[model samples]
Structure formats: structure tokens, C-alpha cells
Target: MAASVDSPTPAASLNQEESTTGSTPFLRNGTVMSRSVKISSIPDPSLGTDERVGESDRAKRMKEDSLLLLRGFDSIAQNLSQLSSNLGSALQGARYLAEPPTLREIFHSRIENSESRQEEVEKEKIEGGKNTGLKRKFDPDERSEDQGNDFLNENEQCLEDKKLKKAKNLAVSMATKAAALARELKSIKSDLCFMQERCALLEEENRRIRDGFGEGTRLEEDDLMRLQMEALLAEKSRLGNENANLKRENQCLHQLVEYHQITTQDLSASYEQVITCLDFSSPTSSMMEEADNEDD
Candidate 1:
């Protein structure tokens, strides 16, 4: 009776064990599904060949465009630096020119201030003398004074001519420089406008590529690599967990199978014992019948 009672316990345990192990395949299915999702998320080299080509070309074009823009900007910056220096020098020159007392004016004013009236005063003093000899001597002094005045006038005229020439040359050079500067500035402005438009287009293209695009589109190269690494790590962790679960389920199945084997062995031994008793009882009954017959 104890054996009978204990016998159902193993069977019941087996039933519970079977029920528990029956859910493992669902876990395997989940693992398979997760693996398949990972596979599907991977880029297919076969189908994405054209896309890869397009991406390479796009990257190349963008790199070239950016390089060109950078070069243009560098040149523009250099030109601007030079232009600023030139403008500063030009401003100083203009300020100097705009102020009073230019070299020519100073030279002329000094010449005028240095003019001598001493010859005329000496003439007047000599003419006021009563001696005829003094008058005769003063006549040559007047002629000498006139010749000195003519020489001063000639010197002034030469300085004026030289100054006028210098002024004209300076004015011509300044006009040329100003015109060239204006042209250069216009060119810079146009280039800047072109660069601005180019930058706008690049920004728009970048936005189009980044916004709402799949998988790695919105991510930088480093971010995408990091994300892929994280995904791989997560997958590795999940697979480890699944393997652990499988090991646990295998252990449970092994234990259940061991119990079933033990139960089968016990049942077989009991069957053999019952069969021997039946065989012995049959022979004993036959013998008793023979004895009874003989006695009668």
C-alpha cells in the first residue's frame, strides 16, 4: 500500500515535470525570433549594393564640396586681412592729407617768411646820405637786390612744379588702388554669397539624410558603432541567459527521466514477483486435487 501510494507521487511529479519542460520550446522560439530580428536588422550587402554606391558617391561629393568651401573661405579670409591692412594705411594717408600744412605748403610758407627786406632798408638808408659817393655805391646795391629777388622767385617756381607733380602721382596711385580694392571687395562679396548658398544647400542635405531615416542615418559614425556594440552585447547577454535556461531545463528533464527509469525498474520487478507466486499456486492446487482423488 505504501508502494502504491508512493508510486503515484512519481507519476504526478513526472506530469508536473513534463508540464514545466513543455514551456522550454516557447523559450527557444523566443530566442530564435530575437536572433532573426537581429539578422533582419543587419544590412544586406546583396540588396543594398546600389545604396552603398550612392552613399559612397554622396560622401565623396560632400567631402569635395566642403573642401572647396574651406579653401574658398581661407582665401577670402586672407584677402580680407590684407584688405583691412591696406584700408588702415589708406585711412591714415587720407587723414594726413586732410590735415593742414602739407609739405608743399610748409615749404612755400617758410620760403615766404624767410624773404629779406634788409636789402631794401639798406638802400633807403644809403639814399638818405648826403654824399654823392654813397648814392653811386647804393645804385649797384639796388641792382643786386633785384637779382636776388629774381633768384628767389625762380626757386619758388621750381619747388611748386615739383610739388604739383608729386601730388598728381599720389592722386593717380590712390585712385588706382581704390578702384582695385573696390573690384576685389565686389568679388569677395559674390564669393561669400555663393558660399552662403552652398552652405545652405549642404545643411538642407544633411537634414534630409538625418531626419527620420532608418537605423544609423540619424547617428554619427561613432554613435552608430557604439549602438552596434551595445546591441551585440545585449544579444550576447540574452544568448547567455537562454543557454542558462536551456541548461536548467535539461537538468530538469534529466532528473525526470531518471525518476521515470527508476519507476519503470520497480514496476518490472513487482510484475515478475507476482508472476512467480501465480505459477507456484497453480502447481500446489493441482497436487491437492490429485491427493483428494487418490483418497476417495
Candidate 2:
């Protein structure tokens, strides 16, 4: 009885082992399915509040970082657009400087008029002086007065001629200087175009660098791009200052040209007045001679 209680018979033991083996699969399957369902339905208790807080903080940081990147990209885009607009305006200014046909035409016409007027004045003076001197014989005292008046008038005419010549020379010089300035403007335009191309290349290189580095070197890439943008901004400011200076110089040149033109016009008007006075004086002198002949 003690042996039976201590150890089961082999058949009975074998039967019990077979029943346990047969029930183990169902138990394991039910327990595994229950545990899986529990895991799927419930939050993990092992994930602490600290870990959740850390995850939330990390998400917040990522969102903030994305916003910052978007802002930076927007700023960069605005800067690029401004730079392009500046370049375009500069090109337009250069083009205007290069092709000043209207100014050239005005200068040419004025110069031609001055030359023709000068020739007409010279011919008129020579013919009128010869005719007046040969046509009339006056009393000795009257002749002396006439000669003195003629001498004074000739001196005035000579001075006027000299002024006209100076004006013509100045106009010619100004035209030549304008041409030189135009050439310089053309060179500046070319330089600007080269700078634009270089900027484009730099932008392409920056894009390539960004693509190659992806997310790993994001901070380093931002720093590098920031430095590049700063450099570009500095260059743009310098160019803008130079452009402003050029504009000022162009305005000064235009003012000077206008001043010269006014002076030339005034001088021409004065010359016309002198010619009209001479014509009026000639008729008076002939009447005086006729009066003198009647008195004789």
C-alpha cells in the first residue's frame, strides 16, 4: 500500500503523461491568445511617465525644428527674390546708360547748329565790314569816330566767336566722355551677369550638398548655408551701394549736360540779337550818309 501511494503504476503514469501532453497545446494556445489580446487592448504598464514625457518633449522639439526650418527656407527664398530683382534693376539701368541715343542726337544737332552759326557770323562780318568801308567817304572827324566804332564792334565779335568755339569744343569733349561712360556701363553689366551666374552656381552647389547629407548633418548644413547667405547679403549690399553711386554720377552728368546746353542756347540767342542789331545799325548809317550828301 505504501509503494502504491509512493509511486503510480507505469500504465497509469503513462496515461497521465499523455493527458498532460494533450492538454498543454490547448492551454498554451489559450494563454498566448489571451496575453496577445490583453497586450493589444491595453497600454504597457512598463512604459513609465518619464518615458512618455520624454517622447512628448521629443515630438514637440521636432515640430519646433520643422517650423524653424520652414521659416529659414522662407527667409532664404525672400532674399533670393530680392537679389534677383536687384540684379534685374541694375541690368535695366546699365542698358539705359549704354543706349543714350536721345542725348547723342541732341548734342549732335546742337553742335551742327553752332558750327553753321559760327560760319555765317564770320562770313557776314567780313562782307559787311568790306562793303561799309568801301561804300562811304566821311569827313575826317566822322571817319575817325566810325573807325573807332568798327574797331570796338570787331573786338566784341571776336570775343563772341571765341566763346562759341569754346562751347563747341566742350560739347565735343562731353560727347566723347559720354561714350566712354557708356562703355564702362557695358563692362559693369557684364560683371553683374557673371556675378548672377556665380550666384546660381553657388545655389546649385548648396542644393547638391544638402541632398548628399540628408538629415544627418542638418545643423552643420544650416550653419554653412547661413554663412553663405550672409556673404551673399554683404555682396548684394555692396553692389547696391555701387549702383547708387553710379546713379548719382549719372545724374550729375545729366545736370552738367543740361547746364551746358542752356549756356549754348543763351549764347546763340545773344549772337542772333547782335546780328539783328548790326542789321538795324547798317540801315541807320546809310540814312545818315544820305542826309550828309543832301546837306553837301
Candidate 3:
């Protein structure tokens, strides 16, 4: 800004000097215009202390306004950075809430399988019980062999005894197979009962975990909502404060405008004096006045 303010002096000086349309003031050793004479040295036809003071004050106020606007931009940037960080943190917590139902389903399925096995065993036991009942009904016929004296022929008696022995062996084999099957069925029932209990416990635990997760989710949402509300309120406050600051700046500008209006009257008087001298002296003075009027 200082460089720009200072750079204009050389151009103004060239305009005042002898008319040389192509006189480009070369800066150091090459291309750019570097050093320039100060504006005070260029002879304006009319000047005063009060106009000088007004110009200086306007420049100072403008510089201060630029500084304030820069600071406001920095504050806005910092707020945006903080908001981004908070959103990132919220995303991480959401990923951890998805695991208990899978374990519960697996446990329940195992329990169902165990119960089905038990049912199959009970069905086999019922079939074996019916066979055992038929064997019991024929048990009395085997006892008739005790009256062996009626058969006096040894061959007939020996053949009858052999047939009885074969029947007895078959009954014993069938009983052994039935007893083994019953024992297996008993074991399977116990295993099913145990699995049912375990699965029930696991399901209860799953419910608790789900409840806990729900509570956590509600808490997080509540916390997030509260945080968001607070952020909104804070933003409102910041905006309000900024608006107040802007209002103050606007007030300052209004006051500055009023001050400039007062100064403009004095400058106008000085300007009228300068115009009188310019009209008698230079042809381009009309153009300069037009340009200056446009700038104003």
C-alpha cells in the first residue's frame, strides 16, 4: 500500500513537467519504475493546512478499516477449522456400534440343532420300547420247558431244548441293543437341555448389549444436538458481535462522511482558486479538471 501510494508521485510529476509524451521514468538499471518524487513537491496552484489534515486522516482511517476486515476473515477461517475437526471425531464413533446380533443368531442355531438331535433320539427310544413290550408278552411261553418229563423221547426233548436256547439268545441280544439306545437318548436329552440354557443366557446378554448400544446412541445424539445448538448459538453470538462491529464501522464511516463533507467545502474553495490560475495557463487543465471530477 505504501509502495502504491509512493509510486503515483512520479506520474503526477511527469504530468506537471514539460510535455514529453514518451518520457518514461526508468527505475534502477532496467524496466520497473522504482523511486518517485513526493506529492508535496509538485506545485499545485492552491493548498492549505486544513486540506492536508483531512487527506491524512482519510488515509489513516482507510488503512485501519483494511486491518479490521483482515482480522475478521482470520476469525471466520479458524471457526471453520474447528467445525471440521468435530465432524471427523463424530464419524469414528459410529463404526463401533454394529456386532452383538451375529453372535446371538449363531448360539440360537446351535441350540436348535441340539434340540432336533434330542427329538430324533426320543423317537428311536419309543420304537425300542414297543419291541420290548412284544418280547415281554411271549416270556411266559418259554417257562413251559420246566415240565420236561412229558416228552420221554430224548431226540424230541433235545430238539425242543435247542430251539429254546436259540430264542433266549436272540431276546438277550435285542435287550442289550435297546438298553444301549436308551442310554444314548438320555445323554442326548441332557445335552439339549444344557444347550438351551446356554443359548438363553447368550440371548439375554445380547439384549443387554443392544440396550446399552441404544443408550449410547441416544446419548451421543443428544450430545451432538446440544453441541450443534451451542455451536449455532455461538455462531449467532459471533455474527451478532460481527454485526455490531460492522455497525460501528458503518457509524464511523457516516461520521467520516460528515467530516469529509465539511472538509470538501474548504477544498472546494481552494480548488476554485487553483482553477482560476489553471485556465489562464494550460490547455490540458480542462482535461485534468474533468479527470479529477470523475475521480471525486
Q: What is the C-alpha local distance difference test score of each model? A: 0.64, 0.82, 0.59
lDDT by residue (1-296, candidate 3, tens digit) is 45544455787877755344345444232322221344445766556677898899999999999999999999999999999888887776665455344433554565567558657866875786577557657776743452353234445545544544444344344445445645665785576567556556655755665677756756665565566556556755765675577557556555654654454344424434656766475759888998999999
TM for candidate 2 is 0.45
Worst 10 residues of 1 by lDDT: 263-272
Cα RMSD to native, each candidate? Answer: 69.1, 27.5, 56.9
For each candidate, give its TM-score against the true structure. Answer: 0.26, 0.45, 0.20
- lDDT of model number 2: 0.82
| Residue 30 C-alpha lDDT in model 1 | 73
The residue-by-residue lDDT of candidate 1 on 25-48, one tens digit each, is: 886677678889999899877779
Ranking by lDDT: 2, 1, 3
TM-score-wise, the better of 1 and 3 is 1
**On lDDT, who's better, 1 or 2?**
2
